[model samples]
Target: MITLAGKKALVLGIANNRSIAWAIAQAFHSAGAELAVNYLPDEKGRFEAKVRELTAPLAPAIFAPCDVRDDAQIAHLFETIASKWGRLDILVHCLAFGNKEDLQGPFTQIRRDGYSLAMEVSAFSLIALANRAVSLMPDGGSILTLTYIGSTRVMEGYGVMGPAKAALEANTRYLAAELGKQNVRVNAVSAGPIRTLAASGLGNIHEAIHKTEAASAIKRAVTQEEVANTALFLASDLASAITGQTIYVDCGFSIMGG
Candidate 1:
């Protein structure tokens, strides 16, 4: 029902093959969206090379460097898009991070440095990118971000990310409203837990999944591909009228009382 054929999509935050962003990139490619993906360059450049290998099959139109915490890098990234593609149709913001130590300890134990880092990269960067995206999207477009149930509910293991995601969802709504006149749509997909590399740092991530599977009405967790499909819809014309909302793709876990 939804197709993004011919749309230009830029996907940020691909850390590895297991990342939600990578999955979104694959789905976008499958739907015929011309793709460009971002990777943060580490000291050894291993991360970039790994990302390149994982994404080789798609042969993205552009593979650029982007670290959300750096403004100059982000500017260069959009500039590259402008030079190559001239316009952007879909933006997938799948960025998030927090100190692993922050995930295990009590909230009060979270350091100021860690909290600030999480908010800037996970939440504020979306605002920065959206500002850039609007300019390239004179024809209007879709802006999508990845989120989780922890944004609204208390999940002890989610720690600082819970607050960061809360801010991200809030940004989604405000951006959606502000960009409506331009016909730009912004939304977040609050997907259920997946066994991502980042999730592995959560200590008891398996227990969390088990609980989601038992408590959810569907009696199972959602997959990265399923979440990717929902994202594909949001990016396509089918969701033209939808914006400023966090669509739940959690197998009914969010609605359960028990």
Candidate 2:
């Protein structure tokens, strides 16, 4: 069995049970890794309650508050992880945000603030989290982030999020290069469309979902569990030789030829 026993993972951006982050958390738990969840400041107590309800049987880890947008909060998050676990073995950067308006309209109409906010939340946060995680990953570790096909291909209504994911994909490669020297592996999982809370913000996302499934070789949508399985592999020692790669778990959707 590919076990993550004794490993500790920090998972961010679990908006709800349907979130890919939650799926990753469950996968890591099943593989024997202890899980620590991060909740946004606004939803601290609320999400804590939810985590408690979900994790009570296994009692995986305490849900800590972390708003990735705030440097102070991010600093405190890493500090707490260091103090409690003394080290971190895996980091899942599932955080991303964007102005709904910018996601729906023409890319050229995106406002400066909306564009900047999208990049900061959707792309740069991964870099910020990785920088802090390296200090705690003394024995080497894995860092994974989520991306989409929109990064390289234009998808309707994906708008600025596409460019943001492009930057995120680039960040994964650049950071992997720098972090590999320390024995840490960094990668991105470009997933097929799922009805996550974040994806709901996109205008007419249902159409995008249909288009993706219709194009995929499987002729069906990819589930969060499918993506989580890929994340689990990348986070395990079995994938020690893999880094700076974007693994797509989209039922071969990204490989479709016109």
Candidate 3:
């Protein structure tokens, strides 16, 4: 069994236990990685409280307040990691945001602020985090991000989210190519629709789930566990040779035609 024993991983964007980031953190913890978590300031207590309820049965961990959109916070994060752990072996960025108003309307109707905010927080933030993380990972590591199938295909109500995901996918490839020389592999996991707080922002997420189940080879919606497990593989040494790729854990939904 490939385990991340003795490795240190920073998992960002965990709002609660139901979050995909939390699932990945749980999986990584089970595999023996020392965990460092980051959450928004307003949500830090809730994140820490749930992490306590979840990880108490396991081991103690650190949860830091990080609004990834801030360069100061990002710089401080890597500095803290360096001070505490010396080096990082993995960084999992699962942060994304979009205005509900934009999501509920047509893509052409998206407001300029909503569009820019979506791309900045959801797409460019990954690049920002990776650039800083690479400096702390002197011995080569892995950087994984979350994406969705809406990036490639049109899904109603996905709106600006689809384009944001597309940009994220493109950024992943470019970062992978640029960082490969440094042995810092970068990849994205294009997960299927999982019911989370953020997914509720999409006007028709439930309908999308039903449609995916009807068309996918599995004939069922994917779970957070499935996505988390794939993320574990990519973050582990088991996937040493893989990089600059989008691994879809969509229950074969993307393969469906018509």
Candidate 4:
């Protein structure tokens, strides 16, 4: 019985109905966690509008504009959260991005600008968010992010994201160790390929999905909800002993080999 009653969770990187973050928001809300969901600012407010519609039922405790690249926006987000909730129990970071060209080109050819951008968004943002999160939780809390198998194993078409996620996993360990004494735990969910807006940017993403399903022990790819459910447990007291880990939710695909 995983229950997050009275818990407050900040879920970043929700883009649409298919998004893993959206799924996580739903799961957390369903488990009785107060939610704060983020939508990145866009030219026409399109991205914000989409998240609003998808999370309408959840009625998140807060919906703030966040672009991790902007320090002011990140600072303001935590300030607003402090005003409304005073503290937090869970931080769900599902943010990750790489320039389109970097997703397809030879790994060695990845431009310096593209690599920097990917590492900033996909990796460093965890540290940025976790820093704010720990201050809010006087008692303790959980910090979670999303990653993929490509972080460790080689996968074609994943390109720069591989190194980005690799750094993210490594950061998870460091953050966990630093925050452990504070009773704050940090972890990540390494999910299988899903047909989300983020994954669509990867070259031959559809093929990756199909191949993952075929190779997985269950003979099927896992769902966003499954990943969300795992998140729910981690956010709950059930995972108090777990931290600095990249738990896999890939339907056993991460364990298999050719």
- Note the Cα lDDT for every prediction shown: 0.93, 0.90, 0.87, 0.92
lDDT of 3 by residue, 129-239 (tens): 998898888889999999998898888888888999999999999999999999999999998888898898896888889988899989999999989999999999899
Q: Candidate 3, residue 37: CA error in Å?
A: 0.1
Off by over 4 Å in 3: 43-60
Clash tally, candidates in order: 0, 0, 0, 0
* lDDT for 226 (candidate 4): 96
Expressed as tens digits, the lDDT of each residue in 1-258 for candidate 2 is 678999999988877788999899989999999888877765347766775676566565656788878999999989988888999999999988888889888788999999999999999999999999999999999999999999999888888899999999999999999999999999999999999888898867788789878989999999999999999999999999999999999999989996
Q: Which stretches of candidate 1 lie over 4 Å from their true place?
A: none
lDDT by residue for model 1 (55-159), tens: 999989999999989899999999999999999999999988899988788999999999999999899999999999999999999999998889888896889
Preferred candidate (TM-score higher): 2 or 3: 2
Which candidate, 1 or 2, would have the higher lDDT against the true structure?
Answer: 1
Q: Candidate 1 lDDT (Cα, whole model)?
A: 0.93
2 versus 3: better lDDT goes to = 2
Candidate structures ordered by lDDT, highest first: 1, 4, 2, 3
- Residue-by-residue lDDT tens digits, candidate 4, 1-258: 788998989999988889999899988888888999888998999988988988889988799999999989999999999999999989999999999889888888899999999999999999999888899999999999999999998898889999999999999999999999999999989999999988999868889989999999999988999999999988899998999999999999988889
